[model samples]
Structure formats: structure tokens, C-alpha cells
Target: MTHPHRTSDPGVRARFLLAATAWTVLVAAVLVAVPLTFAGRLPDPVASHWGPSGRPDRSMPAAALTLFALVWLVVAGTGLVGLARARGEIRRATRAWFAAGLGWIGGFLIGIQAVTIAANLDRDGWSRAASLSWQVAVVVVGAFVLGALGRLAGRLGPDDAPPERERPGPLIDLDPGRRPVWVSTATAPWAVGLGVVASAAALSFAAAALWGLAPAGWSTALPLALAGVVGLAVSSVSVRIAPEGLTMAFGPLRWPSRTVRLDRIERAWVEWRSPVQVGGWGIRGLPGRATIMIRGGECLVVRYTSGGQLAVSVDDAETGAALLNALAARKTA
Candidate 1:
């Protein structure tokens, strides 16, 4: 009872696009309007960064800050839209989640801007701005609530199920004394490049901050480093199928890996999977039903007796699937 990949309805996709765009625009408008409304009261240079003591250590022109925030929001929102559009056909759940993400990002950015403006309002100088401890918490919680609402809004249409297409893999006859192993690796060059660039940027930022060139840059550096690590982690993976089960080791270190015990496997198959079918690249879908899509093509799909399915894109998937099926059968026998 496997579900075939399906494309979302045009109307539904368009509606989501419209809703996401509208939400982004609305948040952008608010981001701009709030500053304009208090233009007279805000300091020339608003507090943009607060240090560990909750004091403003860095400042930027109010107008410049507003513009930067606006551009960030626009870029992020547009990226989400572009990703959705590129997928061609997207699952309803995936589409809704993407839309919700757009909404959440916009709202969160807006909230941050709001907090900054509020802190700098009526201040004689950026140094006098209030602390953001409580305000930040409120913004995070509010953004999460808005994101949940956005999810509901995006899921307005009727629920449609994808077509069912079950494919059973071929089994190979092997001697009881023989041991077989299949190994392959999946890599995404784009992800690797992005990871390297982000990591380099983080290092540069940290150096600049350490040298007092940009004392407040630590804030930006931390997130960039995190993103770099995540990008690298998903850039490449080594997949191996052996008598023990199917194992996938992530990144160069191969420290974090997942294994599906041969005994737990109900069946295995080779499927042609696209990033769109599994909600873009990298690790996607829920824990039970997940996909590791480094590139779009043949994937080794393993279904567990508990009904969970995991798909990993790799070369020579046919052989891997065949071997897995044969091993599972032998274990059962």
C-alpha cells in the first residue's frame, strides 16, 4: 500500500502562493509602517545589537536597519516561493508546511523589528535602549502561534490522497555461506559549496569580531556557523547494505548514522524519487516516513514491519534493493 508521488492541484498551489505572498507583504508593510509611525521619536541610530549584559553595544541608522530587515524578509519569502514552484508537483502536507514556514519567518522577523523599534522608541541614544530578554521570548511564542495558524489556513482545501502503487523488489538467490555487501555514496555539490562558503563567512566574521573590527558580529557568526554545519551534514552520505541491515552514515565524520535491522524490514524496493516528492532536499518527511534526497534519481526504499518507510537516494539502487530483499527473506526463513 505504498503511495505514489503526486502533484498538487494548480488552484491549491496558486492559492497557497497568493496567501504566502500576501502574508509576506502584510508583514513587510507592518515592518515599514511601524518605524515610519515613530520616526519622530526614534533615535537617529537605533540599537541593533544587545550584548550578554542586555545592553546595546552596536547601532545602525534606523532607515538602514529597516531596509535591511525588509530585504531579508523579501529574500526569505521569495526563496520559499521559488522552492515550492520548482518542485512542480508537491504533496499537500509539504505545500502547507512550506507556506507555514514562510509565514513564520516573516512574522518572526517582524516581531524582532518591532522589539528593536520599541526598545529604541523615545530614546535619546542607542545606548539607552531597553533590554530584550522578555520581549524576545514573547516574539518567539507569538511567531510560533502565528505559524500554527498559517498551517491551518494553508490546509483549507479538501484532502486528496496520492495514487497507490506498490512495487516489490527482486530477490537474489544466494548460498548460505556467502556474504554480500553493497556500498554507495550520494553527494550534492551545491550543498557542499554552500556549506564551505557559510563556514568561511562564519570564520571571517568571528575573526573580525575578535580583532574588534566588528564587535557585535558574533551574533551573525553564530548562526552562520550553525548553518554551515547543517549544510555540510546533509551534503553527502555513505549508504551501505550488509547482512546486519541497511546503514546510512551522514557527512564525512559518519558519526551520526541510521540503521534498519534486517529483521524489522518487511520489504525493500528501488524507486525513482525526486526532491519535490519528499519536500525538497536533505532529510525530509516525518521520522517514520523519511527521505534522504541528495540528488533526484534511483533510491533504495526500505519498509519496516511497523509500516515506517525510509528512502535514501544512491547509485546502483536496483542491486541494493535486490540484496536487501534477499537478506530479509533469508533472515525470516
Candidate 2:
């Protein structure tokens, strides 16, 4: 409830750590408990492959199964640790998502193991694996856990406050009185092209899965769903600078638009960068400060009150940055 503007409180930090620990412990416990409890009972080479019908199609030696479990443990553990240790980009919200994802994956795998054990209780040669219901249940449970933990993680810490001293005025050289309400907007052709390509690929994959050319199930659907989202995010982008702040949104759906309030902006400038500087391209970087590297050339950088910065690549970035700075200065003055 107490949302600090820039500082993080102890309670949130504690909860975050606790959630991360819970995820790791649960996974480790399941990984160890599954084999120890059912090692002698399970078939020497257990059914390991699942078909589109969600039935076991192939088998793996018990030793191979153990190796697989260890690999999963290592991968899941390393990711959680990295997310916890990394700063800036993996903030509270993102961290919670990572935790939830681990939780979901761990839960799903455990569920599969449980189902396998139950199915093999009286089996002879091959174990008849359970239906896909368990998988669906795992997904639902994971989603619920994610929402709950995300809410518990709280907002960005209030520690990153703005400086007391005001910054120097804009270097635009234009008289504030002479300039009318300035505006600049442009579409990212590269992003649009990328979106189209991704959409085409997604469609192809989905068709293959649906028509039985490939396995149809959660694995096949997840990537298709993500492709749709990426397509929407990149296909249509428009940037606007006004008295309220600088706004960026997809198409006309502006409710979720990313905006830096006029009061929060300290200064603005123009810069050029590549993936080497801002991590990667296409809506990349951290939460408070992100780099919208569409085509990657000139970018308008806005330094805000919370000591955070955001960069958006666009044509005539100098003009956009100058206008933003002028507007911010007038408001601050």
C-alpha cells in the first residue's frame, strides 16, 4: 500500500527474497523426492516422451531421467540466482515474474512426475502417462502464483529521487514565446517489417501444429501466443510530446501508453546508441529507463525526476528532445 516514489522498503525486499527461496526450495525438494521415493518402483526405462494425445510414446533409462532432472535443477537454480543478483533491469515487477515462471515450470514438472508415478503404480512394461489435464492445471496454478507474488513485490523503490538543484535550461536556441505547441511523430518501418515476418512464422508454425504436421499442445501454442503479442507491440507505434509529457503507445489504444510526466522530467537530449549500449533492440532495457531501439540510430533521451532515463530512436531526435526540454523547462520554471 505504501508505494515509495523511488525508495524501496525492507518489507518488500524481504518478501521478494522469501518468494525466491520458496521457489528454489520447492523445486529442489521435488527433484530429490521424486526419484528417491519411486526409484525402485518405477520401470527401469520409464516412459518419457509424450505425444499430441498427451500419452507416453517413448522411454528413457532411469539414469538418463536422473540426468534430465539434474539439468532442470541447474538451469532453474541458475536463472533464479541471476535474476536476484542482477539490478536495474530485473526490478521488483520483473523479478516477481521470473520467480513465478520458475514456480510454474517447477510445479509443472513435479505434476508430471506425480502423474507418472500414479500411472505406473501397477504397470509392467511401459507406464501409461496421464492426460494433459495436469499440464493445464499446472499452468493455471502458475498464473495464480504469479499474480499473487507480483502484487506482493510492490512498486519500484522510492530511493531514486530527483536532485534539488534545477538543471540548466534547454539548448534549443529558440525563443519560448515564438514556439507554438510543437509536435513530432513517426512510424518505425523496421519494427513493422519485423512484426510482419514474425507473424508469418507464427502462422506457419500454428498451421503445422493444428494440421498434425507437428505436435499440437502447450509447447506449440505458447510461442504462437507470444508472437501475436510481439506483433501488436511492434506493428504500430506513435510518439507524442505534449504539456502532460512525452507519450508512446501502440496504435490508438493509449490507456497503457508509456509516459514521462512533465514534472518528473529533469532534462532532455539527443544521443546515438546500439545494442551494445542498451542491451538489445525492440523495446529493450530496464523498467524505469528503457531503450526503444527500433532501427537504432539517433535517440531522444529524457532524464526524469527519479534519476531514471529512457531513450527512443526516431528521425529528427534532436528536434524532439529540444521540444521536450523546452516544455519541461517552462513547467519547472
Candidate 3:
């Protein structure tokens, strides 16, 4: 029989716990694994020698950084799922995740200090302090970046898809339950597309630079770098339901817009991007996996979830919920 308070399935009961436990356990296991394999503790001393063994090690700590990253992702997912299920725990769960982030940063900083101490038995105070400061730059800067991503995710936080929103009255005559229309951004497609192109172009330029092909003029790489900076700053665009087909905004950033017909929209929803396989964010599959970091949970991959998903990052995600609800209604009807 259907439940009373909850009209729809709330999904698994221990979802939150499961997500949290899985992450925490994974980190603990890794922390244990690191020291065992490295034989030398993390943040190994910044070496001054050229010998492979004596070189300042970066790979280990970078690998270990995954622990902090995994924890953040798990917590973020947990927080989002829980918040969707019930607002009662939003604040509490958010705190736990935030603290987890800070804790990870703190632990990383400590690890760096430990490395310093282990490497130098009696380094002068200034030396140790100076070294530690550099470590902070790596750890803390990354922490803030992740924090920004988290904030964006929170901004797109989901709400209970209004039960009635799905079911419109007969007057609309369109599908009754059909709700939510994918919306678009105002930014130009070029701006957003250019950002992606810019990222690739910048990487290519870097490769060129490494090959000693750095140009002496603006064409050398300035345009590519400039484009990338603009692209990153340009924001992303999206298409929601519309009379024509779907309305697309250039980005969360205000810009020109385009409305493509629903006929053109091949498909939608989150999926592992690249060789496109519709699945969860960061999900991997037969083809490959998503390269983009979908901090905003539940990305709407408009068009077929195949062949390099369009990176139409969006905002005011209530728009997405509306779009999904519309699609669900249409599907059910």
C-alpha cells in the first residue's frame, strides 16, 4: 500500500548513513594504506637532491589528497539527498559536511608539518614555519576552491518535486501532470562553449610551450589564455521547457539566449560525460567517464547522453526541478 505522509517512494532509509560511512571508511583505509606503502610518512620532506629517492615527493601527497576529496564528495551527496528527503536535517547535515571539509584541510596541513619535522630533525623555527606556509598555500587554496563548488551545489539544492506541479488541471489541456520546462541561460553559447574550448586550447598551448614552441607574439598563446579566462568567467547556459521547444540561456551569467525546439532536444539529465553514458555525476562506465566535475548535483544533460555531453551547467536549479517534473508528468500521462 502507498504511504500517507510520503506520496512517493523516499528511496532507501540508510542512504545518508550509507553515503557517509562509505566515504569515512574509504578515507580511513587510505590513510592506513599510505604510510604502509610510502614507508615514509606523507608530505615527505622537500628534498634538495636529484636522486629519485631523495627528490621532493609530490605524487604521494597528491594521491593521498583523494581522501579529502572523496570525503567532500560523499558528504556533499549525502547532504543533498538528505535535504531533498527532509528539510529538518539541512542545517545539521550541512554543518557536518562543512566541518568535514575543514577537518580534512587541517589534517592535510598537519601532515605537511609532520613531513617537515620528519625530514628535518632540528630545522630552525623560521625554516619550518616558512615551509609550512607553502604547504598551506596548496592545501588551503584547494580547500577554498572545493568550498566554492560546494556552495554552488547548495545553491542548486533540490526541493520536493511538487506533487501537484506534475498534474496540471485539464484547462492547460496539455498533459495534466506534465510540469517543469527546461529553461535556458542568458549568456551566449559562444561564451560558454568558448570556455570549454579555451580550457582545451590552454592545455594544448601548455603542451606547445613544453615543446619550446611558445610564440613570441600575442598569437603565441595570449588569445587562448584570454579565451579560457573569459570562458570560465562567462558562466554556463541551459534550455528548459518552452513553447518553441526549450529555452536556453547562455549562462547563469546574463547574456543573449536561444530557444531550441523540443524536437531538437535529444535527451536530458545527469550522466557520466564523455563517450556519453547517462548516469550519475563522476560516474564511469563501458565507454569511459565524465571529465567535468558536476558540483551541482543532478546535472541535466540535454540532448542524447552520448558523444561528449554538452557542458550546459545551469543555475536557479528550481528550473531543472520544474523541467524534470514536467518531463515526468509528460511521461506518466
Candidate 4:
């Protein structure tokens, strides 16, 4: 029940590694033993039964649960290492790890089914070929997921502070060697867009698999289902600096859509842009003259001293707004 605390000190890391390895070995032993004990107490998991006589319908999910636990342990171990080494961006690494884990697990499951299809090519030709491809994609997804998770986990805390350091960043250590800094908020619109897509895909898959008994009529919903996954893939990463200005990217397909300079802002303000103002959900349209999201209910709206305004969703809008003001103030003062 206790959560693992990450530490990078050589002694601490060694203790953790030993304990984790021991724990993993213990869990694996249980998984192997329990399944073997009950091997055929249940029918083939793929077989679905409705009548009173057809082998009930419970054993497979339980087996799947055991399998999932096995995979999760492996993932958690890798994530632990990232936590140790990622001094500054633990949060980022964590997030990427989760994304990658999910991607990999999904790939693995789909790939398993694909392998079955491929095995019966003469019996299930198209399905078999598709399954083979799915398996490859899954393996690839699983392999890289840990790496991404590490990057995301490292970013979980304040900007650049080490995992062992006192609180994280907002104030950068003044070092001439480190140049312009870059950051971006996950933002509200981007979140809503992803949420909508993810929800749709999940619901579609569930509905088709559970309620749908017919293969022909249920075939067409796939395109729309896939589009949601694609939409969820889109994200906005903001990279800014004392010199780099502000550049926001929408997706892999598009370049930076908005830009704001550092010197132009004459004054700025911090406020929460109500979802009402952003036309309610998703980044499909620019809601208003100013906007941003994701922070703790706020955004930094900067008015260029010489030009237009830039609205950014940051963790602490007021703090970020003040920081920009301080920087600008120092420049002018």
C-alpha cells in the first residue's frame, strides 16, 4: 500500500533496486503457479457463452488481470529508474512513461489478436495480415513507451529542480551558460480535445465488442473511432524563453500557430479564461481575442508594450505573469 519514494543516492538506489527485483521475482512466481494450478478449470477465453450450459464466462478476465499485473510490474521498475536519474524533469518522464505504457499494452493486446489472425491466413486472410502488422506495431510501442514515460515523469514537478532539491523552478539559477528557457502548458482546449477523442474511442470499442453481436453492421464505425485516437494524439507544447519568444505547436501536422515576443509587451494581466469564452471544449476554433488553459485555473495574458497580446495557460498564471513583469521590469528599471 505504500508508494515508492524515488532516491538517486548510490546507496539508496542500490537498496531500492534489490528490493524491487526481489518483489518482482516473488510476484512472477505467484503468477506462474496460480495459472498452472487452474489451467483448464476454465474454457478458452475467446469463447463467449450465453446459455446456462456453456462454461459460464468468468475465467478469462481473471487470467487477463494476472497478465496485466505482470506487465505493470515490469513497467513500474523501469519507471523507478527514470525517477532516479531524471533530476530535473521527473514529471515529464513520468507522463511519457504512462503514455508509452498504455500505447504498448494496447499494441500488445491488439498484436496478440493479430498474430492469431495471421496464423489462419487461408482461413482469415485479411484479418491475419492485419494482425501481423498490429503485432509489430505493438512490440515497437512497448519498447519505446518506457523511454517516453521517463521523460514525462521527470517533468512532473517544478521546471528544473532536481528530485532531491527543495521546490522546483520558476526562478532560474543565473548562469550565462544556460540560454533561453522554453515551457508550455498542457492547456484546457488541448485537454478537452483529447478527452473527447479518447472517450469516443473507448466507448465505441466497448459498445462494439460487448453489445454488438453482428459483424457486418458494426463494421462501419471504425473510421470515426480511429479519428478520436488521432485527435487525442494532438497536443500543444509551448517553448518560450527570455530570447526565444513564444511558439505554440498544435500537432505533428502543423507548425507553430501563435507567437508573442518578449519586448513588445507594455503590460500584462493574469486571469482565468472561462470555457464559455473559448466556445466550450476542444481547440477547433480560436475562442476569443485572448485565451489559454491547463494551469491551476488561470493564464498569463501579456500585452505587448509595442504590439498585440499573448494568452498562455501556465501552472501559476499570477506567478508567471509576475515573473514576466519582473523580467521586463528589470530590463526597463
lDDT (0 to 1) per candidate: 0.81, 0.63, 0.43, 0.45
**Between candidates 2 and 3, which one is better according to lDDT?**
2
> Which of the two, 3 or 4, has more lDDT?
4
Q: Can you tell me which runs of candidate 2 are displaced by over 4 Å?
A: 1-7, 10-15, 52-54, 67-71, 87-91, 127-282, 285-309, 312-333
Candidate with top TM-score is 1
lDDT of 1 by residue, 1-333 (tens): 434543335577667667767777787777778788899999988999999888899999989756845675766565554555454444567656776776677778888888898899999999999987888899899889888887888677745565474488878888888799999898889889888999999999999999999999899999999999988998888989899998999986885998878888888898777775576789888888999999887888888888888899998888888999999888888
lDDT of 2 by residue, 257-282 (tens): 77767898888877666543454456
lDDT of 3 by residue, 168-228 (tens): 2112235555443444442335555777887787778777777777754336466888877
> TM per model?
0.69, 0.47, 0.32, 0.34
Residue 299, candidate 1: alpha-carbon lDDT: 87
* TM-score for candidate 3: 0.32
Error in Å for residue 117 of model 2: 2.7
Q: For each candidate, C-alpha RMSD in Å?
A: 5.6, 9.2, 12.9, 15.3
Candidate 2 global TM-score: 0.47
Candidate 2 least-lDDT 10 residues: 154-163
Ranking by TM-score: 1, 2, 4, 3
